[model samples]
Target: MHVTKEQIAGMGKFERANFINSLSGMKSANLIGTKSEHGVTNLALVSSVFHVGANPPLVGMLMRPHTVVRDTLQNIKDSGVYTINHVNEAMVEQAHQCSARYDSDKSEFEATGLEEQYFNDFAAPFVAQSNIKFAVEVREIQVLQLNQTELVIGEIVGVLSNKDYCLEDGYVDIQAAGSIAVSSLDSYHRTERIDRYSYAKPDEPLRSIWKTQS
Candidate 1:
């Protein structure tokens, strides 16, 4: 159970990748959709999506090293637009398949049987089967010097979802949408709504928002 830095570096490539990925615990599972400048669409599953800021509604995602060609990253950079679609229970299989390596000309949407959807003037496509989806415009790309991996930061421009999943307080009910999360690299998980807690304040006892309504 005790793994040292040297031990981690000495581990096999696949083993190290899985171990390092799982160490981050459960992460948001999303399908990143992009389109090449030549109009070829691509879909890829990514779990590294994270919130950067609320005021600007910025989101960040990590991409593997650019030593080799990366279609998704290239498309996003070329088009300056991408879509993040939450991978729900029903689309788990298809979404996971997107992680497989494919030729640059091959579209994961077509390879995995997922439907492509678009809205407004966005240049990227969205997963039609996803219950919750949002489109973003690329703002910046930062490269990690230690590793060649790149970090892409984008600003969310539009979000689409079923009205039933939206709460009075503007919170989207992810559980109602049946969205799923990922553990490690390949495991899929379903989540449940625990309890909604009231905003914390100094010198105040913690309380449940659900209890107040009941």
Candidate 2:
């Protein structure tokens, strides 16, 4: 555990990757369930979904270098639209299966038991069981040369959720929604909201801490 990284590169590629994976944060990407140009459906698992700005409701996600093999990236490139499905404990198995390399003619929906549903005007299908889901239109794509990941920014057009999951101030309880997170490469976990706070400072009073006296 105390080994230096500079000394590890001499070990090998897999060793370097294993070291990085152990230290990385849990990144859960929103899988974009989409339809290809020829009507072939594509389920692409992504590792990057970030909230860029809230004014216009912008969100960002990155696709891997294999934009060539994944049709979801191409479909969004062509149609400028896609859906983001939240992965929960109940759906993680099926969602993870989507990361596999399937034939262009096969649909992840058909390949897996996970249900898919479409909206009135949107041609792409969204995960039917996702407690929190959104339809997004592609706004821009930025290619990062460092890793060849295409950072895609999108505008949320539609949102669907169970009414009970919403807070009085309009923030959805993602933990209550059962939205899960993706760990480094192939691991998934459920998130639990420990507390909801208004504001805080390092020196501020701590109300929740109980002091013990002997």
Candidate 3:
């Protein structure tokens, strides 16, 4: 149970990777959709997507080292637009299959049987089965000096979600949207909201906000 840096380094490659990845616990599972300038669409399953800021509505995700062929990263760089679609429970199998390595000419949408959707003439494709999805425009990309991994930061240009899941105060009930979470690289899980709390004040007791939401 006690694992040190030296111990981790001594572990098998696959074992270390799995252990380190799962240490972060459950992560948002999303399908990043992009299209090459040549019109070849690509879909990649990633768990690294995260919120960068709320005021400017920025989002970010980390791309593995670019030493090998990375179609999604390349397409985003070439086109500057991409779609992030939540992987709902129903689409887990199809979404996970997108992680498979495919040739540049191959479209994961076609290979996985997931329907591609477009909106407002956006160049990137979205997953038709996803209940919640959004389009992003690349704002910046930085290559981390330590590991050569790339950090992609983008602005959310538009969002598409079911109205039923959108709360009065602007909180999107992802659980109600049937979105699933991922652990490590392959495991998938559904989530339930235990309760919601109001913003904490110095000495004030936190109040349950879930009961007050319309």
Candidate 4:
């Protein structure tokens, strides 16, 4: 169906969110981040983990506008730390529960019965049950008021993973990871890798190099 921007802009917030969400389908890992505080401060789920660069291991995520003051965003602003956890098919139900619209005083970890593993100096608690986890310090946050979204950058200071899921060359076997992929918005699916390739030098006259070298 052909739809114009002006026409789509007329839809309600929920409708627009749904439409955009549908367009995105399943996003990356729906991470649960908690604040670094005296006791457990805040817990929330986000679905926006993305890579920015490889040189310094940078990661990014997004925070949407809050119906009420958002503690996760606020806490990240205050404490400058957060955590990220990967979701598996088995935890989808509980992971989905982490998305509930709870008050700032509420903790989704406690609400969903997910255990938080506290570290020696980690500002935020890690999701102990998750096969993969990351402890990050907020590098910068760009607030895009026009879109009502925040682009947060974090320096990956710590990383943890289950050994069995990794390969010798640092490749991850998705089939063993048992992770789900999202498409168009709310849809979820799995990913599989079927091939590998290597490149050849341009000046090397193709097959004449390897055998003729002798």
The TM-score values for the models, in the order shown, are 0.94, 0.87, 0.97, 0.81
Query: Which regions of candidate 2 are displaced past 4 Å?
Result: 11-15, 67-69, 201-203, 206-214
Alpha-carbon shift of residue 149 in model 3 (angstroms): 0.4
Worst 10 residues of 4 by lDDT: 205-214
lDDT for 44 (candidate 2): 75
- List the candidates ranked by lDDT, beginning with the highest: 3, 1, 2, 4
What's the true lDDT of residue 195 in model 1? Answer: 91
Candidate 1 structure quality by residue, lDDT tens digits, 77-177: 88999999999999899999899888888889999999999898888999999999999999999999998899999999999999888877777888789
The TM-score obtained by model 2 is 0.87
Residues 15-113 of candidate 4: C-alpha lDDT, one tens digit per residue: 887787777555775565767465555556566778898679899887775732267778888888888777777776677777677766677778888
Worst 10 residues of 2 by lDDT: 205-214
lDDT of 3 by residue, 1-214 (tens): 6889999999999999899999999999999999998899889998999999998999999998552239999999889999999999998999988988888899999999999999998999999999999999999999999998999999999999989999989999999999999999899999988899999999999999997895
Model 3, residue 92: displacement in angstroms?
0.3
- lDDT for position 35 in model 4: 71
Ranking by TM-score: 3, 1, 2, 4
After superposition, candidate 3 runs with Cα above 4 Å error: 67-69
Q: Highest TM-score: which candidate?
A: 3
